[model samples]
Target: MQQTCVIGAALASCLAAGTALAQDDATLAAVEARGVLACGVNAGLAGFATVDSNGVWSGFEVEFCRALAAAILGDPALVDFHALPADGRYRELVSDDVDVIARGGAWSIGPDVRRGLDLAAVSYFDQTGFLLPVELGVSSPKELDGARICLVDDMATGPALDDYFHAAGIAWQPVAATGDSEARSLYLAGDCDAYARPAAELSAVRATFETPLAHVIVSDGSSRVPSGPVVREGDDSWANVVRWTFNALLAGEELGITSANVREMAATPSSNPEVNRLLGTEGEIGAMLGLPQDWAVDALAAGGNYGEIFERNIGENTPIGLARGLNALWAKGGLQYAAPFR
Candidate 1:
């Protein structure tokens, strides 16, 4: 797909200042003209983002990029995926190389305030964790005193691991690895006693290990982390489009809506007002976000709702196989909640 740079009236209202692009009307216009949504993501992360054998990008993060494209262009396939190395992703987004970032970048004050980026919904509730082989017989991270731990250097994971271990008064040696794969190899080869990374990510890696079941995750709650998408700050139009694109997915799940049922629900009248409005059977919700009246319908149809995406991507059926502990809908005792679409 060719790159178009059109930011229309809908986008103009949403773009905010101090964001990466800061509402360059021309840039947005250029995007629209190109007719494709440019997306940036990590080079490779098993459950997050990766290219498959057929050269198709697939993962939870990639689903989001497609969702946004479907919402904006009325066609989900209108997305141009740019797989970027970890070090190059932030720069790519800031320079307008991609419309948004769906890779698993953490939301922090530094990126929001300094990088001119705006973070959207927390799609995945994650936590940092340590993986030690069963042979180590370590019951907890606290037992890792004087142990050599391998982790990516200078990333958020290092500081988080340090702070948690420091507060516990645990002294350990840091064996800095250049990237996530390197860190895992160092630990797996006995170069280090443990490997540290996001719990879901670490679990995914361990699944590919020789004695996968022998790997143990530290049970501390402090490691839980949240991950989400990002766009240039100051573009309220772009931000809202991405933010509610996520919320709509959550709301669809809450309302028992799915891609299969949305079309039918849209045709028939129902007592539920929120459902009516969300499906564009009653309210102009899409107009508020500068999308077609059936935008939400299309977004949901592009993939399943948030819950569906969860189950398919990292949920029990997939290799990552994360249970919906904190990611469940608010009604079912999870943190996933959406603002009223009225």
Candidate 2:
């Protein structure tokens, strides 16, 4: 069954500092009424989102939808995953076809206020990069001059490629594909000399190749594309729920909470006051959002923490093999820092 996005923040001043969450969370109400979360995710980005032959969904973004289901519905399996295409994703979100959009699109400017969508916490810190077959011998993107490149017809990627190529004074023919999977097919069939997109995406497709080592990815780290879930603008009450759910994942990692241990941790409050507050063993944090007191517990227990989700879905051990490079905790010097639970 299809539901619609009605939830839809910020840090400190942007969240309006001490503004009160709305007394009635319309989005949450709608979700509860439907009994499932309608999440729109990438249709073919392997590690970010994917579907098995049995039609079961699993991936980094899939876990996020599940975690949200656990938080609001008390069941991780209650979510309905909607595979969205790049061209029409925002239209689907805006039309209320999906409750929230969970994809690789950046929560960047222009997309936010212009589209009346509010971007949530950063789920993955990504950049625009390149993938070239080993036979191409193009160690750097600059090395490819007048190369035919397979480009995905997405919002950020084409402009990024155009700007980079123009700046480097190199001209290339583009082999356009509608989506990632199509682009991968174009690359494998030698339709283009290289393919360009987020490096993590390239790695995911590369891993599925018959000979993974036959390709090399070239990246200048020239773009900062931090991605997260998105919802319609103006629903502070529901927005806070999404914001804090992501925060719970990050804070759980910082506080040493895990899916295997979240129940145990919630069984008895630790001496740490923050953990107690986050886990609802000592505060009305959930009540403030008009949710059950065990909200964070269920969210954390659904898919462990941000780190755990990363490692399990797209981390170094997986075929996607994405490192925690810019996504590490703030304490450890990366950009991922959760706002205080207090």
Candidate 3:
């Protein structure tokens, strides 16, 4: 009787382990069966992700989605873009409505690590600041005493700005708007003395305003914000899939490889083993991610490298006309660095 009981217990334990393994496989398979990756994006952030006249999506965030699609399904077009409002982003992601949220999310301990979500990678680094007329003569954000500042309702920016103002001993009027666009209009139309937003966003909006000389970004030393991708908590598999996609682009750029030149470089194998591994002349890294062996190639082919994507979307010739100040490749003295593929 004792021997029979021991055999039965061992059998049950083995069965439980098998069940857990099967459940994990089933979850991943279910996601793949959906055919398209649903990505949550900001409703309308110009340089980030926004729908256009013909209802086509384009922008920096859109490219990230496209790249993920290409890496996973070998088709860059296999993405369903969900333009979720800022207030709804968390709900949408937490409810399993989307696979990932590609919005311009800043990493914070409270919302990122503590709120049951994982931040993938910092794709675009930004700073928080205010845009006011040059006439305000406010060289520092601390000088905006009793000045009305426009901020979007239900966003972290308000609290952050308020904290800054409070600490600096400045009493600023808080004017809340329904959305960022509305807040921008309110400030640009002279409804408020200044408008506060992420620095990159301010640059994008400034390009659209007719009165370029009318606005100036208030330089506050405390607005440095890191923007990245996010996935649901405990989903390490999916998180790695998204994180390394951004890293791959940075890696490609640092290695002096571009989409235009990848094909030619692939043919004549490099003596550089690391380049060979990255170009997939030597490793099954993509297969390990449940993608084709040349997945990174497809990602680069869809866009270019990290530098190309930046230049095409927000660089000097683009409407945003942003200079690569802190975003330059590491070798070029910028902060963009990636782990070795090997």
Candidate 4:
């Protein structure tokens, strides 16, 4: 009787462990079954994520979602975008309303650890900076003491701005704007002395102005915020997909692969081992992630390489005109470096 009881107990324990393992990948299974990758994006952040009058979504972050869908579903168009407001975006993810949040938000220790969220990667390195009229003749933030600043209320930029001023023993007043458009309007109307926001965003805002050269970005590296996509904690499979999809984008850029040439490059495998592995010519990276061997190819086809996406969306020729400062490849003294595929 005792031997029979021990065997039954061991069997039950094994079954419980198997159940836990299955639960770990529940999110991935659901995504596959749905056949559509639902991505949570910003309601309207010009260069990051925004919809046009025709309801077509196109932006830097939107491209990431399309790439994810292409890698997983083999079709970039098989994606459902949920426009989320800043305050409730995380909540929507936690409640399983969205599979992933690709809206670029600053990654901080507090949100990652306390909010039960995982920041997939630092897709964009943003510096907290101030934008004011070039006529102010202020080349530095320190010169803006007692300045009234227009800031977005929902982001961490407002607090970071306060920290900078308080630490410098300077006094300033903050005029909180509900969103980027409002902040820009407030600043342009002379309601605020300076507009405080991420440098990339400020650049985008400046470009929209009637006179682009009328404003200057004053940044001394007081605060550097690395922003990226977010996924629910405890789902390793889903997290890995999002992380590697971003890496593949970076690798494509590093290997000189672009949307226009990805198919040709994949057809004729490269002698470079890294390129071959990334393009699925040499190894089984895609299978390891439960995807096709040409997953990276599909992703790149959807959005082109990281550099290509940047140049197409927010680069020098675009209204944003943002140079690839820290976003440049690591070989060019930038922070974007992809891990080895092999």
Clashes of each: 30, 2, 0, 0
How does each model score on TM-score? 0.88, 0.89, 0.88, 0.90
Q: Pick by lDDT: which candidate is best? A: 4
Cα lDDT, all candidates: 0.79, 0.84, 0.78, 0.87
lDDT of 4 at 75: 95
Total colliding residue pairs, candidate 1: 30
Residue 113 C-alpha lDDT in model 3: 57
User: Least accurate stretch of 10 residues (summed lDDT) in model 3?
Assistant: 21-30
Return the top candidate by TM-score.
4
What local lDDT does model 4 show for residue 42? 77
Model 4 C-alpha lDDT per residue in residues 225-272, reported as the tens digit of each score: 888889988888888999999999999998899999999999998889
Can you write out model 2's per-residue Cα lDDT over 159-195, one digit (the tens) per residue? 7778888988989888888877788889888889988
Ranked candidates, highest lDDT first = 4, 2, 1, 3
Q: What TM-score quantifies how close candidate 4 is to the native fold?
A: 0.90
lDDT, residue 333, candidate 4: 93
* Displacement of the residue 116 alpha carbon in candidate 2, Å: 2.0
Task: Give the per-residue lDDT of model 3 (tens digit) for 1-342.
Answer: 133324687888877766665643542454579888888887777677778899899888888888887877778888899887654466788888888888545566767756788788888777777888898788888888899988877666777887787888889898988877788779877999988877787887787788776778866658667777888776666777888888888888887789898778777789998778777788888777766778787887778788988888888888777788778877777777998787
Stretches of candidate 3 off by over 4 Å are: 1-31
Q: 140 in model 2: Cα distance from truth in Å?
A: 1.2
lDDT, candidate 1, 1-342, per-residue tens: 233344886455444332444453433445568999898876677776788889898878888888888887888888899886643368888888888888545556667788888887788787777899887788777788888988876456777777888899988889988777787779878999888777777777777777788888875777657778888876767778888999898999999999888878878967999999988888888888778898888888998798888788778888777889888877788888988888
